[model samples]
Target: MKQSNRKVSGTLRVWSGVVAATLLAGCGGAEPVHPDEPFPQTQEQAQENVAAAPIVESMDAIALDRTLTSRTRSLIRARLAQGQAQVHQQVPVVSDSGQQLFLNDQGLNGDVTAGDGLFSAIGDVDFVTHQATQDRIREFQARNPQRPLMASTFDNRVRVSTRPLTALSPSVFQPGVPIPIFPAGITFAVKPANSLIITDASVINDPTRTYDPCSNSGNPNGVWTFNHLMREMANTYVSPSVLTEHWLRQWTVNQNINGWTVPARTAMMPYILTPWPRVGGALDLTRSPFKLVAIVNRLDLGGGRGPAGYASGNAGELRFVFAAVDRTSGTCGVRPFLVIFEYGVPHSSCDAVKTWAQRWLELSAPSMVLGSSAYNAALASLTQQVVVRNAAPRKPNGSAINQIRTNEEWLRYPWELREFHLMGSGPSVNRLQGQPTVLTPGDAHNDTPVLRDFINANTPAILANTYTVPTTFPTASTPFLGAFPWIASDTTSFWRATGISVNEARHKFSLNTCSGCHGRETKTGFTHIDEFGTLSPFLATGMSDPSIAYVVQDPVNTSLNREFFEIEMRASKLDSLANQSCLASAFHRRLTSAH
Candidate 1:
């Protein structure tokens, strides 16, 4: 299944242009704060304040709404609108071998072959080319070393004519001519069913051919099998179900952690410290924050799971635990942090995973082991700083504080389709059937501008107007949510290029988007649904459409209709809202005139 080249069909086209213009305009605005204003307090002061504040329990709408102001909310909404438009318009062309190419009409055209000098026209004027079978055979022979030779006989047999004299002399054959017969051996006598029969040497060496459980007892140091290693790894790590819950709980608690303890920090240290040695200079911390969170472990269970686990459990299990330690108070609590993990059986004929795990353990042992006290102290200090700084009120003179807050709030709710799914329903709804959209995280294709803007506009109070030292922690002005949609868009594009349907692609994108904001609790509720408004009846229904069970049950709907419907619906909804707002008066006028 192939998705349509047109990303922004019909209605989305207009809105996309509007969003792009708005984003460009927003970027040109002056910095929100004045240069003359007094510099904000030191980083230590901010940390102390964060450490002193009380930790919140839940991240419900009430809490989010309370935290965000009108301006911030507007910003988030605008950003969401813009992100949708961006994702819909950006159609990234990716190959099966993981090659990514930006696609447009020109690129699409280039992929098609037109009639040329070497190529001949086929049926209906289609261009086609023919090659000799002998050439193909030669290429095949070159690639395959063990090709068999076909038996053949010489047709011109002049030698047979010379042998006619010998044929003329043919006469009655001798009666006792010895024939070259293949060797024939006598069958061994059958032994009684219960009787034991054996040769001395064979018995000692072979033992029981029928039932010998310990055949390879002599090879003690033999390679470990993949299944054995996978089992060991599984036993080492928490189960996927449990791990998922653990990560969700940790993020839900919004626990702070010691920066040193962060897996990403350690994973990325080599790249940061030795940037020039790597292929792309040093690892860009800004682009690869996941490196800080990722931890390579020799132990079988340490690597985290990916999103594929939701269906067949190919996704590994990741247990992300966020804890904030207050050094001054000597107290530790859960904090908000993103954790992703994957789990699955290793692909190996034998001892593959075992060998890999063994090698990894040997190499990563130093970084894999974590001491409780050391981790606690690191987390405590990091938490104290983040809490205090984030809790402080923004200075009136500048917008840095605002920007920081925006970024933090954006992170808090990160754009995901799952969030929208949850927002559409409540506790009254039976969540067995999950949301319709599958959302991903990260801006591989750079589609997060609108979401960022929206978050920036909505969370005015949390915006940071001043810069603080140690800018790593979440701040009021950080555009956490801004980057989410972009990430999700990229992930979706990657999946779609692999022949996913637009509807299912949208559903997955939506799931990632909603999950970014709603967390893992919403995963179970992320069930598949049918067009008849019923829960998906099929068990294996990721890309499969419940509405159409026939026609080979294609999960990916590669056609343009579904995309068109979704875009039209989204645009209409936005247009209706714009009609009611004075800010979009000009837009409404243009729309009305076009109609």
Candidate 2:
């Protein structure tokens, strides 16, 4: 059987009920006054004038939670889990820039430094510091005896290995390539053979290269080490949550190499192999997990003063902010991407909101290792859920489907028809002061002349719904006047998903032209164009065609249209049915491993 296009059949009724309730509230218990009488200024005054206004206070939560939704919550949970698994427990091997020495406790204790270089000692030295230095020298000698320890002009500097040291060749690390070495010492038996050993008193001419055993193609300076450098990468940001720590631990364990002094050495290897390698690698190594990015405590102003709701008193009433960061490598070059979620709290207390934002940001930020694509993939996956779930479904009326079919026919068998007919009716047509006519579906003529006339006459209606007051139904007039339970439910879901503010999503969808179809014509009327178009007495005055040309003229609207076009194009680019189906599939996959 052909799949039914109807996912929701009762939407019209549901929206109608909502509209009725809104109208009742707006009328404010007053009898219909003459057209000449001034409308009530305050909602309370309106209520006094109308009979039985629906109590709207009960629904105020709708605007409060517009951004939070269940699907979004799930996605966020998945991301948090992945982040925790990928980021916690991994030891940082390199410095913040991935160019200097910084290792785990055990590795640091066993290693020694001399003139900006690290080495292993062959024998005991006078002090703890000196012994540590000597141990590195001995370790280097054990790997290369041909070059005995040579004294440097600088005190405490010794060249223990005969092999010369080479500077890092690349600005970024590339996977699968051998690291170039000027002087060879204990050659690590890793697959790439880039690992090196050092001796006490020996000053590694290029300490940067000594620690980074991965290929140096992407990172020429060998600055992409798994140490603090990975933690500092601008693009390697994450949302903080319980899952964040879990992922970190998972990455640390996977990257831990047996007998390796730098624990990050093992961790970073996996990152180098992945795209957006640091976060991706960490996520991969940790087996993908989920974590929380932020949470909503309360919205200070219920009435327009928040990011999600309409503005009322002060525009700066919203107080909350959400933020995330990634730290991997400087050469990684991607900036620390941040998303700010604002709430209805006063702006004066933004600092407190920032504190919350920082908590999540720090949690999500990658630590001493290159975060892998797995983390980013998890984020993207979660974000996709938000985008998909929040996207307004095609109009329930078969009109959208009919349009598609009509467009298809135009593409296929071009000669089958000589003229095109755009169907539908409403006040949309009235916008055309004068234009040529086109053959509608019922009309018989297929000739070009007939089509030309139809096009000229009906072109105005074609642009009608596209630019109207937005498609989403308006739930309330003045901020906080009415409540939408669905909005609250959606907000809750979003909170559970990403822990960031859902306000942005709510605002985006609320402003969608499609949703306006369900909205009431007047603040005190129960009529919506979608249901009571003919019955609505105000239809003659309330409805106005949105200017399609305005959409093309306004930069913001143009950008929005461009983005939508790109998305449609991307969907069209799929080569096979299977690929296209995957894009629409709702099945959820575990982004992280069971471990």
Candidate 3:
């Protein structure tokens, strides 16, 4: 793909003077046109175009535990409501900013600052603090038997990135841009040799030189680590449920690494290599074993950036800031981090067991060692703060403080809304409650104001269905209010799978989801990376005369066109998919041994 063609991040950076006109020809003409594209066509042609998009096999493919979903939703809501009430009662006289109210609201404040004290010691990698963290991890596992620490039994289940590849020799790399250390198809090693940095071009080019994360020997200066077993399962190709390429795409984003500005599709390789907790199999797929995935981003705060691609709120104090110093070299960098929030679910969404499959999805603001004891403890502390503050009665002052209360349930996280996906929808879990009611085709396509209002108004009916596990999900006859299906699909073939129409899918996922930000019109479903031929030259390729200049002028329709072809072409493919039995057997063996 051309450099200019790469999807822009938070801001859209497109080529300067590429005028788009021919591509949008006949859009306003009276002739019947494809609902998605502006191309004028006869009624027969429009019908044929509609049939080209992929279709899901069935409207109701997944089965879910509605009772559990409903209960969980109620529990979460009650706690949130309590928090809201507490805020109002404590701060009767509210300020315009609401910051003071949030900070001073005393209901959820804990007496001990142990978390703060422990965080302060991160720069030193203090042995005492490390032991304390280990102890916490042990306690967390004991309390939640469902999330087992698998890495303890098998040492080869984790991988780490020792240092950024030097071979690319990136120059003209703007320092202002967040530099990505992991490059696509770059070779990595389990351990750093005498020279931690590898610069030889030949060695870098050799595919055999690649290292397995399971073989990591505890590199302290590593960028990140992964739960290799989870990586293996996700990397393995399966029908509809698991796409190895989709798994790869989750980690890859465009970043400038080693001075080279390039796309880093596999940089997040280390995330999959994160070590498993002492417990095992806490995360299970709603569809395939690899269905549940986690991502840990090293919040690039060097250039005054906030957590996960935004400026941090609260003057950066809300972020879990820590300094990682190299013990041997004494080189240090202040790093604040975020990881997918861990929660337990039953086995597969289709056949949920008595044992819940725990998943880490949303980004948690509170910091701790990944998969260590401190993580759950910190999470518990924050969750406690959230629940208690809202539920607590007014302070002695009698003024109500509605700190941390947001009409939207998803916004409650405050820090993770940009990247959170509540649940993976699949046929087996289709009936699982919490899925929102589907909107009619007319409402989905032309009713932008209604969709926006539905998201913002937080009415009783909308609130009941908004963030909670849905009591019912949309089907072919009835589709979701937003373009949610495009987020993650259980289709054997994505986009192409039979289900909703292209026009409805485009609006729900694009416009309704993120207000069409992140270059909304250029996206292929929820994916931000460039793949569909919606760009200038590509859009003109299929024209009656390829020599003519054509580009989808409207970003919205441009996005629709890209998504439409992504399904029709089945262009999403993967490299290789590693099997999971090895890790699964080892995990079970260790659990049995422990028992």
Best by TM-score: 3
User: For candidate 3, what is the total of clashing residue pairs?
Assistant: 75
Measured against the true structure, the TM-scores of the candidates, in listed sequence, are 0.18, 0.15, 0.20
All models: lDDT? 0.20, 0.19, 0.19
Model 3 C-alpha lDDT per residue in residues 60-96, reported as the tens digit of each score: 0000112211111100000111223332222111011
**Model 2 clash tally, residue pairs:** 133
Candidate 3 or 2, higher TM-score = 3
Residue 514 lDDT, candidate 3, scale 0-100: 29
Off by over 4 Å in 1: 1-252, 256-342, 348-449, 452-525, 528-595
Off by over 4 Å in 3: 1-231, 234-453, 459-515, 521-527, 531-595
Alpha-carbon shift of residue 59 in model 1 (angstroms): 52
lDDT of 2 by residue, 186-277 (tens): 11111110000011111111243212222222222322112211121111122112212332232233221111111221332233223323
lDDT of 1 by residue, 278-343 (tens): 224422212211111111111111111111111111111112111111112223221222221212
Give all candidate RMSDs, comma-separated.
31.0, 34.7, 28.1
Rank by lDDT (best first)? 1, 3, 2
